[model samples]
Target: MDLELEGKNAIVTGGSKGIGKAIAKELAKEGVNIVIAARNKDLLDATAKELSKETNQRIIPVICDTGNSEAVTKMVNIAIENLNSIDILVNCAARPLVKVLNHFHLKHRMTIFGMI
Candidate 1:
């Protein structure tokens, strides 16, 4: 089905694997150029190359640790530079905080939980 997405651009966080990668693939199939962000440069590059070949759409990769605000900002800037403008954003990046919470004090954990 045509999504009327030809020439559009998108940024998909955590797009090197799993759900985010699937979304990026679908968007690329719909004719959308994409900037896929993830922390692993090698994985991101591989995924980008594979998707670009499969969908015949531009797929750029940006290395970004989504838990870091500065990294996220840089990723956005890179995406914009590569794609010209962002028409879609898929925020699929996530951190498994369970292990981290185990190291924290109960009060800190409570604070973090509240934030979550």
Candidate 2:
């Protein structure tokens, strides 16, 4: 189970709960420092504190909304500054266009995914 991930830094988007939380926990178990980002301050703070207590790992909670370009940029910048580098990126964000992502008044649901 040695991922050779000791001292490595990781970024987990939508990491406040569910799948993202599970991923963060696994990474923490591997001795990886985690930067968890979400839009909710309460969720982010609570998750950070809980994870830190469970793993004794450095947990940094970043309040970021992935749908905003500016916020995404800020998250990346701050993560680079804080974690040194993003060795692992766990992108669990769900960008849906079902309600507001329509251009030209088109109706569609978009789940965007890509590497940063």
- Which lDDT tens digits does candidate 2 get at residues 1-116? 89899899999999989899999998998999999999889999999999989999998999998989999899989889998899999999776666564552442223243222
For candidate 2, the TM-score is 0.83
lDDT of 2: 0.88
Q: How many residue pairs in model 2 have overlapping backbones?
A: 0
Clashes of each: 0, 0
* Candidate 2 worst ten-residue window by lDDT: 107-116
Evaluate all candidate structures by whole-model CA lDDT and list the values in order: 0.92, 0.88
